[model samples]
Target chain A: MSESLIPAETLERVGEVLSGPVTTVIDRREAQRYAYAVGDENPIYFDEVAAQAAGYRTLVAPPTYVTHAVVQPRTAADLRTDGLYREGTRIRLLVDRVMFGGEEWDFLEPVCVGDEITATVRLAAVDQKEGRKGPFVRQVRETTFVNQFGDEVARSRMIGIAR
Target chain B: MSTDTDTAAAAPDLATLEAGQELPPMHKFPDEAQLFLYSAASHNPHRIHYDREYARFEGHDDIIVHGPLQGAWLTQFVTDWAGPAARLLGVTWQNRASGLPGEELVFSGTVTSVDAETGVVELEIAEHTSDGRLLMPATARVRLPTT
Candidate 1:
């Protein structure tokens, strides 16, 4: 956790909220576009007919596609105001600093088109380290993906480093 | 839209390429359309990805691409080069720099070592900008199918 933007209390709070599920509906265009964006060109992701022929009734998303579902605000102030960070924060604790570090995910099932999925995130761990770059904070977040009716789909372990 | 037939390299393909042989080129350009597509595919609603104004306020010049999108592309680059007979047991990478809009990226690597008995080859691969900045660096182990 970064001491600047995220306080221990804030981290705790964020952890609490991450326990429950947050739902978002999948849109067709977005799904297809995402597949194209990744340069996957995998028909199972872009064409419903192709996906059906491949044994899926609906178009499926690439295994790592869930990263696009959560939208972050434009401003640091907004992040704080929305309770994304601690009050009067300057540095972001999520994604390591204020940006992306890295991520890893495992797909248990495909996220088919028209599936209303919910993701339940958990703060797995946070550790501080001193490296050649500088002081760094590593945070691990675990998220479980599920469909509308609550069937588990997959799990992701994302690690972010803060400078 | 690459078919398996397109990837039908001969068995022991790695045997043909020298230890330091360069992998085939894979291109990536940070564009608005690509950003939006990545966001939609990844279900990532992160505004910094497709919203320049939002990204500016967040300290980025333009929308940033999702890190995973880069990773996925990196995976594809390796899998595509490994050919149809190669089974990708695992592909992973660490993001060193963020990829923003309009930056040209190319994925390239060299064969580091090969284990013939196991049919596995180790590679040191990275995604680099046109200016030669490293974005994501990773090691990949590919196991080729034997008949």
Candidate 2:
């Protein structure tokens, strides 16, 4: 086994809330913008009548747009050299480069425009794994989204790999 | 239930839908404008997404498409066929390779399992460049309404 790159403190942070209990009301324009951006142009996201005809209560957001809707605004000054916002709680790792590994999502309930949604991100896991390339650290940030009715609307696990 | 942009796809007919059936392929031609719009919409200000020189300096062929943007396409690929009435139970994707702009990305899938009573369908799906390079290998589960 490779020498442990994950510090004890980092490992200890597992299960801790890394970001928001931030809440935002799903907006029609914003959701539509996202759909249009993705070139989705799905009727359920555009036409209310079509959405209703398709069994939706109203125009609905795309499956993964809710995650973007909850992003807390940051000023350009907060941007790092990479043009990405400086996150509040940075997970320390011995490695320097980090790459997006993958994403897993569970959509339990439909998220519609005008619905209040709150998102909370937790450090689900951080561990060292031996990969074909070398020893790498796999970190999972789990975000759970809840609707105004207190229903768990969706869950997302974003995995990051750093070596 | 496989539908692309030109054709309006509906939910799968449980009686006729079976395992080993292939979903109609969906094609996406991602270009600079689409990537830019996605960056703006997602609030991703990463220079690599917008700056070509910076991307090259960082060791990439060109300014690349956002992983999440392709992810949205993957979901759209499934949802368009599932129809609005069908609820997406879950979906997962692995970022295997970077997708550059102006590339034709194709999304295809095979029905792996179907639960008739509960109306849940499992799919093994993937996003590949038209050149046959795999970008993202994925899986999705959707619950189709009986009605």
Candidate 3:
């Protein structure tokens, strides 16, 4: 196996909640925009009347809409300093190129348009593996989303490959 | 509205779907502009999505499609099959290969298993290019209406 660029000590920080929990209200316009952007034509996501008929209190957000809301937008300073990796807390690694591996999501409840959602993110796991290209670090980040009532709405685990 | 009725009509009934039933194929041709919109909406600043030259520099033939965008299409495929009343329990996907702009991707699936007592069904899903190159391999579990 190729040696990992990230130091062993740094990789030890895996499974820690890097940043604090972030909370944001699900905006109707933003939810609609995301749905349209993804080419989802589900009426429940677009029409309030259709959502009500389907037993939702209001227009429902798409199943993956939480992804767009979980991470807060980066500020000007964050952009200047960290570049585009501001979705979560930064991990000190020696490698430069990073790519998204894949994602797994568990939906417990439907997200509505006006629900205030909070996402608590943690580095779930980390490992060094010999990939086709070379030795790379695979990091799994878990984000638990809950509604204003503190009910678990969804859980997302995203994997990133760094080389 | 008529559109809502049309969508509802398109949903598959639980009684009709068997273990080997195949979902209707969904064809998607996402162009460069759609990719840009997805990047903007997702706050993804990765130049590989919008910058063709940068993407080429990164070793891709053209701007590559986002994995999450492919996930979205898969979600729609299952949900469209299950209808609005069905609950999507979970989804897992792996980005096996890269997809480029304007490539005609066909999403299709086969019912792997069905649990009558629990009203649950499992599906093996995949998206492939027109030439049969697999792009994304996925699986999903959904709960159909008991009644």
Predicted structure with the largest TM-score when compared to the true one = 2
Per-residue lDDT tens digits for candidate 1, residues A1-163, read: 2244345654564454354466767777776676666776765666678777755658876555654654322455544321243433232453344445676555555677788888877777666667686667777777888887677776777777766
* Weakest lDDT window of 10 consecutive positions for candidate 2 chain B: B1-10
Q: After TM-score superposition, what is the CA distance of residue A88 in candidate 1 from its true location, in Å?
A: 20
Candidate 2, residues B1-147, lDDT tens digits: the string is: 112454555667988899999888898888888878999999899998999999999999999999999889889988888877788999999999999988888899999999999999999999999899999999999988875
Q: What's the lDDT of the predicted structure labeled candidate 3? A: 0.83
DockQ of each: 0.32, 0.64, 0.49
For model 2, name the residue pairs that clash.
Answer: none
Instruction: Give the better candidate number (1 or 2) by DockQ.
Output: 2
What TM-score does prediction 1 earn?
Answer: 0.65
lDDT tens digits by residue: candidate 1, B13-125? 64565578777667776678777766555545567776677788877767777787788787667766765345454455787878877777878888888877778787888
Candidate 2 chain A weakest ten by summed lDDT: A35-44
Residue range with the least summed lDDT across 10 consecutive positions in model 3 chain B: B1-10
The lDDT values for all models are 0.66, 0.91, 0.83
Question: What is candidate 3's lDDT per residue for B1-147, written digit by digit as tens?
Answer: 001112234666677778998887877888888898888887777778887887888789999998888998899888888888888999988888899987888888999998887779999999999799998889999998877
**Candidate 3 error regions (>4 Å):** A1-6, A80-83, A86-88, A92-97, A130-136, B1-9
The parts of candidate 2 lying over 4 Å away from their true place are: B1-10
Model 2 fnat?
0.93
